[model samples]
Target: SQQGEEDPQALSIQEGENATMNCSYKTSINNLQWYRQNSGRGLVHLILIRSNEREKHSGRLRVTLDTSKKSSSLLITASRAADTASYFCAVLYMEYGNKLVFGAGTILRVKS
Candidate 1:
């Protein structure tokens, strides 16, 4: 199985709008996570959904996982200009414990 990949390389929207990013993987995973990265900085974990779980939410962010399809999605509601950043989806490889693979990520820009 391969790592995850995000669709729509980039997105631009106005504040208060919603942003959705999709991630697809090729292998079985123990868990899936979403992260946010500011320009020239480290990433911050947004949410994590276990393989057995179908969905999870944190604040204004929502995440869903489909183990059968080996896919996941991240949705940000009422996005603010501060949400402008790159979002990535990571998967915990079941074959290799402690190994986490990250997707290329989707760049989102929210204009005020």
Candidate 2:
């Protein structure tokens, strides 16, 4: 079974607003990473937060990890219409493979 599960299966927001998504996992992970995928396009890696790290940020994106709760969150600041995409949270297990195990993902639609 997949280790990570994302919440708020779908979301809709206006441009300039912030979009937040959460992920919960069942086991201890080496790291948690977030990715974004535009409709019909490939997935783009966003930010990654290690189990030892509490938070991380890249550009307009922020990621937080709470190992105690086995959860993580992604925040997109000042979202734009172009931000409309699907976001996924992946769990990395060293004992497994180097590839990431992703969740079902959340669909976000940003309106202008």
Candidate 3:
């Protein structure tokens, strides 16, 4: 079984907007991390919030975790064309062999 799943496999928006993505998972985890990937670029670590933490913010990015619901959310404020690319969330845990199983991903396109 897959550890995580993300919706809206793709997203597009005008520059200077906000983009939101949701993730759902099927197991317990120590924490969840969000990562961004630009076209032909490697995955860049964004932010990670522990299971005990409800939310975390980094720059224009906001992340939320709901352990009980086994879900999480990421909200990017004032998005830009630079944000265009694919976004993904990974669940981390030793229970899963300490591997980062990523969701399919959400592709965001910001129109300039």
Candidate 4:
């Protein structure tokens, strides 16, 4: 399966600090999207940057893509305890949006 694999399976950070996570994938992709899970209801879309793009940011979240290396990085600054959740990066192939696949995910624990 040419999918993404998130690192630090779990992380602990203090509120008002920052959290960084890494994801590596196999095979080329059309785009990559990051999702956040809270209360296990489902995943909420965070960001989606294409292969031709380099970096993208939304509020406190920042994402970088390296197509050649088949990897990506996510940075969240000024993290809050409410931000505690699992983060997963999904590789978007030609049928990405149609049939999205998910990574193992990294659990973020922000302590207040």
Per-candidate local distance difference test:
0.92, 0.92, 0.90, 0.89
**Residue 99 in candidate 1 has what lDDT?**
93
Put down candidate 4 lDDT per residue, 1-112, tens digits, no spaces.
7667899899999999999998888776888899999865699999999999999999999999998888999999999999999999988777545556689999999999
Per-residue lDDT of model 3, residues 1-112, tens digit only: 7659998799898988888999998888888999999989899999998989999999999999999999999999998888988999999865878788899899999998
lDDT of 2: 0.92
Best candidate according to TM-score: 1
Clashes of 4: 0
Residue pairs with colliding backbones in model 4 are: none
Which residue runs does candidate 3 get wrong by more than 4 Å?
none
Candidate 2 per-residue C-alpha lDDT over 1-112 given as tens digits, one digit per residue, 9 for 90 to 100 = 8668899999999999999999998777889999999999999988889989999989999899999999999999999999999999999976676657999999999999
Residue 44 CA error for candidate 1 (Å)?
A: 0.6
Selected candidate, larger TM-score, 1 vs 3: 1
Better of 1 and 3 by lDDT: 1
Off by over 4 Å in 2: 94-99
Clashes of 1: 0
Ranking by TM-score: 1, 3, 2, 4
